[model samples]
Target: MSPLSPVLDGPLQRSWPWLLAGALIYLSFGFTEMMGSDLWWHIAAGREVIQQGSPWLVDDWSFTEQGSAWHNHEWLADLLFYGWVRVFGVASLVIWKWSLIIATFCLFQQLLTRISGNALAALLACTAAVAIAAPFLDMRPQLYSLLGLAVLLELTLFRSPRLKALLPLFLVWVNLHGGFVFGLMVLAIVLFPWRECSLAALRRAAFTWSACALICLVNPDGLRIFCLPLVYALNADSPYRSLGEWRSPFEAGGITSAWYAYSLVIGAALSLTWLLPAVRRRVRFSPELVAIAVLSAAMSATSRRFIILWAMAFALLLAPFAGALLRQKLVQPLMLPALLALTIWGGLRVAPYSLSSGIAFHYLTAEYVFPHGLADFVEANDLQGKTFAFYNWGGYLHWRSDGALKVFIDGRANTLFDDATYLDYVTVLGARPGWIETVEDSGAELFMWPRGRNGVRLTRGLLQTGRWRLLYEDVRGVLLAREGFALPVTLRLPDDSVDTQLTAAYLASKKGDTVATLAAASRAHEQRPWGRATCTWLRRSLQANGQLREAESVMEACRAYFPSKYLR
Candidate 1:
């Protein structure tokens, strides 16, 4: 019952490996990418809540979605993350992210070690879990779900089978993310025996599950926020199907750790089930293990994201069976020579693990840096006005800019912007025909793009137009603006030209004409698929169209023909 008892009462030998595993797990998160996309949108949403001093009732932040339903479901995480940024700046965000990751993995590792004495097996499970979770790793509310699941799992399996501890975890998990429902579902799986569990334990788990469901009432939005998890799937025919992470499993790689490890595990257990068919069988197939095995099997054929869920489950299930196999003298230790070869290979040949140079994933490299340079430029010139922005840059810009420039857009996404506002901006960014005109019309006095991109090929061309001028440039980025310190004619873009086509397609996709946009972009690609700007815009157009598959198709074509021109 005591928190310290797990550490203090245990001898140093057992706890040290678990603690070392914890340290290594947290170290892994250092390389995980920052949450830049929807993660930022959450921060922006939280800021509005902070300013308004009220939870979102009807949406009111953007000029676009003046009145619409906005689910600030992650209000708690948003506020906490946003507040942390305010207290310690972005460095704190990174710290918080890595800390959560380390904490989650450490807990999971502990549970796994509790079930399986093999530290190496536990390490493999966590490492494989990290690989599948790469896509979604970052500082997010959902991490709370992952961490809570570990706690929930421990209580579900290792406790007195009384199911008394489930309520408090369930209550906290509800505020963290809708992933708590997953914990309840996991509980149901662990308690699969409708007939086997004592009536008291069944009643307790049911009451705990109900209590957690009811605890959603304590959130900022009251009982309404509970609808968010369900409502998120309305437009999604199968939200899980559309989203790789939510899919049942095996969708990622059927042969992932589950099949390889789980089958090896449960198969051994099943083998023993008949081999020793005695009441005193050293290995017992608890319903929990069977249920976990079923989930693992399903997820193995689903998406890579669910690999973590089953990896931990199967690892635990395998421990007892491994011992059972050891009893029959079936388990074999590595040969001395082979063991040395593996150790040497692991150290010299394997370059993946880095205790020295921290390897960064693409998100960290692609994420927006604080625009200290641009902010300085505006402060020096004192010529600030509304500016256009990319989705990626919009969030950090909003955080650091101090309201000097009203961003043409920020990370609020389409839901916050409604159809027309989102598409209109999408149109302008694509340099669609009359995009310059659209900027002028919006009174966008300045332009800013991610540094090193050279996105606007016309940046140098604008030098002669006298309608717009290059204001500033830095190693990090650049800035441009219209003449008369006001919006005016800039370089004229061609009608139905590549830029125009890109702009139109981009906007149309935002307007929900995703298919037409994808086809148009595909047609454009047919002419010059490898063109730098064309390929660049083509990728966005594909993503906008929700044609990730087609996007990959174009990218493959571009990379095949022009290796150097890959859109990255």
Candidate 2:
């Protein structure tokens, strides 16, 4: 009695190659550099677990919260990542991430094909899904949750109406990520027979839900695993809420381009599902799909991270409607192949940029995104003591320095440090009134922070106090040591690349050395003329040195190279 059952016979049967090719190509978009900050900490924790033979329940990574209770969810996923890196290598993680993404999408594609009974319709939908998911497809424990949700949906919705498989799914899911709580909510929705409501069905659902809930307790956290979601929720005043991923998609300045695309696709799908009944008259209503969609959409409204779950629910809900459209005689011959061609074309365009041409593993640490160079300087000079670093750089510093530099704070956020500790960190980082007292009380010997707008004020405050010496600086980060700190080796500035030149220009400008600023900025601009930061710096440096004609020429060149909005 499926709405798409009528479309079971068609030319779409012969279009499997096109569908497969397009799916592979579209999924290929996930292959890129490993850029996430969380993965380093996850790998570090995984190594610790492997060494200790059990997950650590205390925060040992940071000096700020040395003995604090840690949730350590995703321990299993961390172990898997460590084992893969141990056996295969770090570069192989990119492949591991891609494989999980492909498998997740395949599950989604399968669900769409089963519900819609059309491969072409499923391919088109999945292409959009991949686009929506691309930004979040980094190599992290969350990838396991994504794959777990897809498998859960496949078992409950696509396969026969049975809840037996959910036991094993929840058993593994509860350890892999805290997202299992959301899965449990989804299972509750799927277990209820919306089409046929009876006492027998309700009783069966209750039994299955109880069984799944019990199975979730098999992890190391025991009963504590179920309370993990509540732990995050109750920490309403936690500084982690400032993170963009935790922000609502509808929040001002929080909406991403990807969320916009997701909205358009979901909106179009809902329109088709509701309006198509007028044209076809035989369109069927699925109350279960509607209920799940409402739940997921509500969650997505609160946090952007839940949009992937909403995408999964909406896709299945959208399938039959997509299939119904595919069945029309006029649409079948003209529309299907055109959509396939467009998907293939998109795949071809993205493939070259997406595929790894042998993994450049150093890019993970070497890139400007991290403070790898500062870490190198600290390690080479054998510098030691408690370090206060940017929140994002803590994991990299911990991993790259091999625990030699104990950080004051890290990405562990609410899991390790409480709101009071985070507020103190915020106070010092922002260079607020009590920042000096806060820093002194913490006994931090080394200060490492980004050299960008966020850290410039803190850096200036430290320098102005005459108690913190500038030890090292790069385009991305600056390292300062408390006065009287001994350096075994004399500190030297690296003049190797545009990054260093830009940093030199910035430092010179701060000291009112116009000639030095212009010199450094000119070199940086010549090296990377297309760089927005470099161009802007070079123009300002030229103007400061009284070269107005040259500054105007640089401005004209920058305007030609970039959009007017970007120049502004």
Candidate 3:
């Protein structure tokens, strides 16, 4: 057969529109560089498993819970992730993640095409789903969750519902990640209300759901894996709830334009049924569809993280309505023109035009993911033991420290910590009542917090306790030591410059060491002779440290440095 024959008449010829459309979706999403902070710990955990040959029952990266039992359900996904790194290196992990994302969209598009029949509607729905789901597209196990959901729907919902086919899927799903529970829920909803009197279909569906439920027990955790989803769900007070991803889409504020676009697509797609009576009539509403819609919507309303799942539900449930709307008497006239324009747009986006900086390979660089400088300083200083850090920075700390230095918390959240732990974290970070006592109680030796509302407040509390000394301060994060801890002599030395003396004085004041700050600032002023800045800084530092008497002495010294200004 001629090569052109396949393009002209084969399955490839028939599906080229959606094939191209899926390619466009993949390219658009692939262009986004994966730079998740939590990727570090996941990678580290995977490496740990590779080294030890088993998941650690006790915590590996937290000082407070050093020996606490840990349940790493995503071990299989982590193994695959780190396996990619082992085989091809870090750069290949990026490609691996991108390949998974693309494959997910491809499966989703195929499912949509089967339901909608119209390629344009499928493309539009998939585009909106991709846009909404973009935030969750990190190089984490959640990528597997996305792909698994697509495959589950395609197999059970769209194709022949075989009981045996679903068992292996669930077996993999259960081991791959805790998201297997989501698949179980979807399966139950789909099978529970089979109105068809056909006994055989009902038996098959029932057997399929039962088999899925049973196979979930096949994981390493056995029975305990069943309780995990419930534990994760009931963790309402988790400090992770403070993260935007964990908040409800409605309650989540400071949204970008992409969210608005996603909202518009959802609204427009769902409204078609109501606006056009014929479209509503065309839809074959099943019990499964109704259940999924209500459940997915409720889940999405509870947390922004579920919005992607809800988006997929919407695309699957409303594809027929969208397809009907596209074929409407009023819409058909414009469909061809719109399709042509959309096709051109898709082609342009997918084509590698090379006008840009050649696909931004710099996104995965050290400057973005790793805290190399801070890690070096801490390692050099031998700063180990309990280290308090923001959740965002915790993963990087865990990874770079090679499990040697332990953090108080990390991105693992429900996997490693309980609600009480997260509550204590939130309370301490908020600088609320008993915050200083909480910090002291944790027995953490070092505090490293990123620059943020909570981090800044917590840092202030750490400094005010008169029990910590500043070690490193930068825009990215600050590292402080518990008092009585000695720093290297080189780090402790103040430079001769006025600015350096001021910085040193500020740090000393934070430590409540008024005498040291005053002496350092005095020396700097004495050297410069005409250094008004050093004298002013000395006076301020003394006042800040509550040395009123010595503060007056510095003020008097300032008059000597700048008589004209002091006299005024």
Candidate 4:
């Protein structure tokens, strides 16, 4: 089959609404200008590979695990994404990201249409699948996985069963992402005899499955690449426990999109099995769908990161049964069109004010920009000694420091850093016991805390010690150096509405400047009433100003809202 074979060659009358809905869903996600936390390191590694003419074989980004053996499994993917950034810039990559996503959903919708023979069924299924997978969509290696899965499913379900087309698919997939193993697993499941399949069909599937597995070794790392999955599995017990993506979907309390998708998929399965047995009988449950569904469900339950993979399988497996059920139960003419319009409108409302804003060369934002500034200060001051860094900012720091500076940890999680390092990070950031000892033992010369998350606790703890000096502070981040260490520039933070006021409150109390402190703190509190840091600052200011009644009122409000021991 040609490259465009998966795209439907049919008329637009029935397909356009479903396609439009899918496009809207994907665009909503793609419009966000922020890249994934991992994108920075990937691009950095890619740039290294391009310039140095060799792939990174050992860890160099972190201070703790520097020179340790590193697994550059997705080297090819890194090269491709970075190459795109070099050629067309980040804005073009954003467009390219959305294009790939759009193509993936188009192929998926085409596959659903083939299976259900109902446009409305395909539309609803595609919309739900996109919704479930929306959060994971970005300019990352996973985009290739999405596209690859769509093509793989189309070939397995819609096209003739042949091993020839799958060889090249696996060849490309192995280099793109480690998720290729998932595709092989799905194929293995499809090869199993759940339904009446011919001997020739079984032989072809067996050939394709084995060939794909063998082709996975075509990468630079060769056979060692097979161990990537094992590394990821072992991460379950590592620092990944604290990361949101690694958490179980059921562990979260609120109603996230994953919950909705999970409920729908599980509900559809149960309803088909028990409530609508007649529909189940009519709609043949193929071996491929059954295998994909079971495997995807188990994986999704274990890790929320795999929910998109499960969502893809869910959309495909449930479409036929859902179509049959809907056809018999309801008859409405404008329902599909209305759904398309609503999805488009929702996507529009949620899209960034400018689709291309802050999406060139780098995703510059207040959250990420502050770290870059801090890194610049660190470089200018020649403070390349041991440094404690926020976990998420490690990637950006590694990229921005031109390989001259190393971090305590990065987004690699358990893949590189040990569990102890992660525990120390959490302990220090949370102001727990052993935190000061952790910092002292590491021989760290300076610490950089992203202000939004851990800055308040860290800043307060450092102030209590009196051993560290505040060097630089901003709404995005705060930097502290060991006492007696001189900075290249004077210690003066920019006057931002948030961090400036909070910092002023802290500094004023230290200097016994009640009037200035209270004024700054009160303004910050009014600007953001919910922030614990602002509340803490305001309360401290009120107390330092000799306003015991107002300080108690602030404390009461804090207890009412946050109810944390830190406030007490």
Q: Which candidate tops TM-score? A: 2
Residue-level lDDT tens digits of model 4 in 365-414: 21323465566556556666567877777777766775666778777776
lDDT of 3 by residue, 122-173 (tens): 6777776777776666667877878889988887673456667778888888
By TM-score, rank the candidates, best first.
2, 4, 3, 1
Better of 1 and 2 by TM-score: 2
Model 2 Cα lDDT, one tens digit per residue, 420-528 = 8788888886777989878868888889998764688888888888999888886678899998777775765443667678788978988999999999999988986
In candidate 1, position 505 carries an lDDT of 60
Q: Which tens-of-lDDT digit does each residue in 535-556 have in candidate 1?
A: 6667867787577987778777
Q: Candidate 4, overall lDDT?
A: 0.68
Once fitted onto the true fold, the runs of candidate 1 whose alpha carbons sit more than 4 angstroms away are 1-13, 34-50, 55-62, 66-70, 117-124, 158-165, 191-204, 230-234, 237-283, 286-372, 378-386, 402-446, 451-454, 457-568
By the lDDT metric, which is better: model 2 or model 4?
A: 2
* lDDT, residue 471, candidate 2: 88
Ordered by lDDT, highest first, the candidates read 2, 4, 3, 1
lDDT of every predicted structure (CA atoms): 0.55, 0.72, 0.66, 0.68
Better of 2 and 4 by TM-score: 2
Indicate which candidate wins on lDDT.
2
Between candidates 1 and 3, the lDDT winner: 3
